[model samples]
Target chain A: MKMEALVHLVSAIYVVSVLLGTHGPVYGRLVSVNDKPDPKNAAATARWLVSQNSWGVLNTISSELGGAPFGNVVSFSDGEPGKGSGIPYFYLTTLDPTARNALKDHRASLTISEYPIGTCGKVDPENPTCAKITLTGKLKVANGGPKEEIFAKNALFSKHPEMKDWPKDHNFEFFKLDIEDIFLIDWFGGPKPLTVDQYLQAKL
Target chain B: MKMEALVHLVSAIYVVSVLLGTHGPVYGRLVSVNDKPDPKNAAATARWLVSQNSWGVLNTISSELGGAPFGNVVSFSDGEPGKGSGIPYFYLTTLDPTARNALKDHRASLTISEYPIGTCGKVDPENPTCAKITLTGKLKVANGGPKEEIFAKNALFSKHPEMKDWPKDHNFEFFKLDIEDIFLIDWFGGPKPLTVDQYLQAKL
Candidate 1:
């Protein structure tokens, strides 16, 4: 009887931990399963995304706690399709006091798109096409703490060696966009989109 | 005769000063002119490019020198279409040592593209469009300069009032991508491209 009681206590602890963990209410939005993305199209899109460099808009926004605002750029991955570990993701980093405060206070939305004239590869000038996506989610600083922070930091450093020597104490925080909804305008056709849940459930 | 010689000497000094003070190479690569851009397609492309909000990719270069070698979603504008100033432009306010150093050592290249998946809005998901434009230009610290710097500071501040109180001594530099060339697919079909010179010359 004591062993069973202990087992029940342990199960309760596990449930409570999950409820209060990083992936709890902060990630409350539900994502529907995505249809199997077309392989050829997905590969092409992934290639184009990964082949380029540079992203971000320099802007200032009001802080959540109220005060002076700050300026920063939100970034993301173009996800290399067919590349198992290359799923696309978005992030927010700022030195702006207001933006940082707001990020900590509420969910943020990120809109992504291509430069009008193109910046990395050959954009078909005559049939020039562009894409835009909006991701709504919350931001959570991912530096320090357990293995997750270490892994994220290493991954960011490996991809951006130039930032290897950035000052350590500066409030340089990295936050991941736990994407909830993804709305896209595939100029080739419809305006349908895939949710994060659908995306995760789809067999890529 | 003395007066003439003095005039000539003064003229020589003026020319020398102008030449030395210019920030770019004395002789830029001559670009060939091309036919007018197809109006219908150009407008379509322009609209598409303008509608994008975010993107992701790796910027594998120095940020201080100007190689913002990281992936971040940047806000950009399509400058007035015909005039060079009206072309698409990206604004970056970075204090990264590497990017700053790179900007000082070499002109920067900005590569950007749409993310893959149905989410980030790829034009032809199957042929994800992208572009690479080399901003081979100079960097200017936007402070305590002559009329141009003052005007620029005011203009930028007005556009971004939130940054009015940022430290004035920060290495606040404006890096302009005097776009030398653009490689784009899906713009003019898939084969041909529009060079910066061509676009400028064909400007309506």
Candidate 2:
């Protein structure tokens, strides 16, 4: 092989690495299943989505746009990878509208997809078989005791080490979704009917 | 290089290539920039975000949540990759809450992040250095005539070819965000000041 051709091949290999190797599994929460969950196993599937994803879209009532529903890309953690508590937690600041909106109206939702986990194979992201989840309920600031705070901090910091060093002036605080409803679509039958209790009690 | 080591290295390269080799260029919209857009070029940066990203969280007022803001994972197109019109378009159906929500209320926002673009490198997704854009405005069904439908259909089908074969029973139709305000954070100074006119008029 010519030296120039070899260099081009090496560069192509490196770019591919950058694209595919970027899903940071700071913890072992990401599960690579050979197949998606059965449509009937709604709770287990919902739990899997929440635990595996490091970030999701947090929704809130936009106080600025005459009460428009606002969504923002935010990093979150449910637990320490496989040991998730089935509750999504976030580190947020009021500088962003999401946190501010949540404070005024706790009604919110968190949406996540299985595509980024790399287990969906060749299917398009919108495919029903690929799986998508939305946890809808109240978004509340964590007023839990020191133990709860520690849990939230450790879960978030494990997946996102950079969070610990975010600007102190931003007044970043821990928040959790007080989920009242769960909408999980893992197969062809539309959203699997799931309850909050089943989700929290499921053993993944 | 020893033959044994070379074989392993070659295999690793092949796997990485398979992982990153998926996003085909419908156009040159997928700019793998060596560096991010300068914060000063607000319109250019915002347009770049819309064109480069194939998916984002589409937000709308949730009629079920009693007028709360809702966000859903969605795939979208601005144009054929690089040929984007600075206007985000989506193929949606009433089977999904996003399209249903929009039908009830047009106020919405589309949020995209630079983390997925692979340009942020080692920077965390939540880090300020990583760019995130929120295009706030009305999410309207495109009834601009058959010309608009053809444009949207072509643009979307080019990126997500599977959409062309999505279930006809789902009744998917074209929807576009009539952008009113832009909030983009590419640097530490906070959301850059950008206008709708500036975003659509910027020369990419």
Candidate 3:
């Protein structure tokens, strides 16, 4: 009986530790860039990459160039972070050919953000908090290998199950991004950049 | 004098036509990419590039992960559609090195969204509605050039004169991004991936 009790306590502590240790969603900013990749900045670069690929609310201005309103909640993803086997990857899905073409050109960036549900105000569109991390990076169609494709598909489906029934080639395509920078903004202040490693550490 | 008046009327008409025609903003969706730049899908690539260089709000989800929130405006100067001389660029200033590093690696894939006022929700920390378009692209640190540095300075100072007094190269740096893709979402659900040209034609 004592042994069983001890086992339960250990298990509980382990679970709590894991939960506490793993960082929640972190806000980041994209500040500067280098023409080529630098190993010395690997930690920062990695954190930005993860943040960019992660999910958040995406916004755009009106088309009339006048008083058009902003849009909300588009899906996005950043892959799992780590070295060697499981590096994080991110992607988005759109039916527009222009967007498709742009993604193919490796010209895409993202602002991954998180809010305390009520931070943005009421869930209504009229008044809401628009706090998030904007990650600037390039977008490329995921065309690596069967294994890579599988991983991409799984990652996407995990986030958005509604996409499961879509045609394999149609709504589904892998988008890999090299995180160039991150821009983090809280409603309290202004937007700024964050390093990839810092973002990752925040997540952890 | 009558002939001069006629000329003035013609010129006024032309000016009004241009204002009415080119007054609005463009919208579209960006493509996705990974580490290497993919050349196969040029259109998607372009959209992605536009998205990467854009700006948005930032939010924090956890404390363990050094998450901070901020809000800032980013400006872009892609040539006026027809003029091919200008590429898109924006201004970013932050004291965070992590954010700066992220912008450097994946400069190609970022998103910048633009929109009119009231398009976004109110500035309520809970509910907000601000409309704008986003672009994703690569970031380049300005190194005192006629074209690069000048453009960056002009855009930043024009919109944000408050920063004019900021120290040079301390916490502020002029950065230029080569847009790869762009995503413009009006939220009216008219059509996806609206081109800048198409948007102009619609106004006419």
Candidate 2 TM-score versus the reference: 0.87
Q: Largest DockQ belongs to which candidate?
A: 2
lDDT minimum window of 10 residues, candidate 2 chain A: A22-31
Task: For candidate 1, report its TM-score.
Answer: 0.36
Better of 1 and 2 by DockQ: 2
Ten-residue stretch with the least lDDT total in model 3 chain A: A119-128
Every candidate's DockQ is 0.02, 0.42, 0.02
Q: Give one digit per residue, the lDDT tens place, for model 3 in A80-181.
A: 222212133434445543234443343334444332222222221111123344554445667789988887766655544444654555455566655545
lDDT accuracy of residue B99 in candidate 2:
91
Order of the predicted models by lDDT, top scorer first: 2, 3, 1
TM-score of chain B of each: 0.45, 0.86, 0.44
Instruction: Give the alpha carbon lDDT tens digit for every residue of B146-166 in model 1.
Output: 764454444334333333544
Which lDDT value does model 3 have at A181? Answer: 54
Candidate 1, residues A1-204, lDDT tens digits: the string is 354554454445434443444121211112211322333353333223332322332122233312111222333333322232223232333443324544544343344444321331232211113444334444446544676555555544444433445455545555555544443433444333455665444433
